[model samples]
Target: MAESENGATQPQQPQQAPKMNVLAQFVRDLSFENILSQKGAGGDVQPDVQVQVNLDAKKRSVENQYEVVLKLKVDSKSKSNGAQLFLLELDYVGVFNIENVPEDQLHPFLLIECPRMLFPFARRIVSDMSRDGGFPPLNLEMIDFLALYRAEIQRRQAATQAEASNAPTQ
Candidate 1:
């Protein structure tokens, strides 16, 4: 409550600092596959490994809080022989409490920042799974989430433009 200059009482807006909190995090799904399981290591199989990564986020509003779930998928294949050496898929979820952030900025923040916070753990899981599956430890390099986000946006824009151009003109 605030008092006006004329001595009349009035309601004041609540003050809140911008904040983001991780309420909880969990692995919703995980899968690991070793395609060359039957064929034991016979010779020096120089691994021609290929890796792919993808990210997604969704916001769930529960009362005053928001839950941001980050979904990630990683796949590895041997390019030399076109065999999938290993495939890893994981859906890591994070429940976040977001406050005071502008609507325009929320989407980027959720997709970029939240995934950054979750990547190390996911990387560890991938590394461990590869080693435990009787292969050398896979040390995943750091991901550039911002660059990835930008690329995705550009791709979407290009696709939209292509669709619009292909539509029947009025």
Candidate 2:
């Protein structure tokens, strides 16, 4: 107990723990193309696959709720002759109810944590889509959302600085 001006003892209040819950998750859009089948190319070929990921988050009309979308693009090409093999695009969305998080930290929490929760489902969809599209099952590597967020912040800072430098003096 700390001494006050009147030497009165006071009890300290405990802080509330942060809360997060996924209200729903679904695929907003999906597309797959079997290029090798379309081209009728039949031959043994080594496959080189590339994956890209993007994220978006927005506040919902309801309080303490947000929508996050994870966009993924997968492309496969023949290593031997660089012929297109297949392509897949997916937009997975999740609705989250979050509370007790600080306002300053909510943006990062949504972009990083919410998508992390939804990635396994998205990965499975990609695998199934590739197999169904007449190609081998494609398993995607885990993403580093924290690194991505840091890089995006740096990019935005650089762009803002460049714009400030390029602005004409009045």
Candidate 3:
């Protein structure tokens, strides 16, 4: 046991970082609504879908856990006459337990890995909703979340640069 000149006690050994662990992970909530197609579509409907998806992730806590929400909307229409076929929205959220991950680097795991993990389940729901809405068993294609996120980042960066350039020289 030794004390420094400032009268502060020092440990004989260096302290180690906290150990991380995974606690729990599962789908918290899911919803698929075929509101329009369920009510208005008729037989002999040959439809084309306009699909859109959005992904978001957040660290629910610092204790190695997070939440990611995958949202998709499909607006299907008859190709021949441009008549409305069906409008469906699928919003699914999944909770993930990520442990031992550094704070600064957790973003990629959220924007990239978490969404990637949740896509398949979300895709299945999309297809099933279309089938359950009186159409054939739909086969929704896979999505590239990394590409989407990169594109968004690029767009934002360009906009910021442009704004900075356009700002009055002061």
Q: Write the per-residue lDDT of candidate 3 for residues 17-112, one digit (tens) a residue.
A: 534333444444544455445666566757788888887777775556677777787887788778777677766787777756667867766777
Clashes of each: 0, 0, 0
Listed in order, each prediction's TM-score against the native is 0.81, 0.92, 0.73
lDDT of 2 by residue, 1-170 (tens): 55678989776666688899999999999999889989888767789999999999999999999999999999899998899999899999999999999999999999889999999999999999999988778889999999989999999999999999999999
* Most accurate candidate by lDDT: 2
**Runs in model 2 with CA error above 4 Å?**
1-9
- RMSD (Cα, Å) for all candidates, in order, is 3.6, 1.9, 5.8
Q: What is the lDDT of residue 74 in candidate 2?
A: 96
* lDDT of prediction 3: 0.71
* Worst-scoring 10-residue span by lDDT in model 1: 38-47
How are the candidates ranked when ordered by TM-score, highest leading?
2, 1, 3
Error of 3 at 46 (Å): 2.7
Top candidate when judged by TM-score against the true structure: 2
Weakest 10 consecutive residues of candidate 3 by summed lDDT: 18-27
Q: What is residue 41's positional error in candidate 1, in angstroms?
A: 5.2
Q: List the residue pairs that clash in candidate 1.
A: none
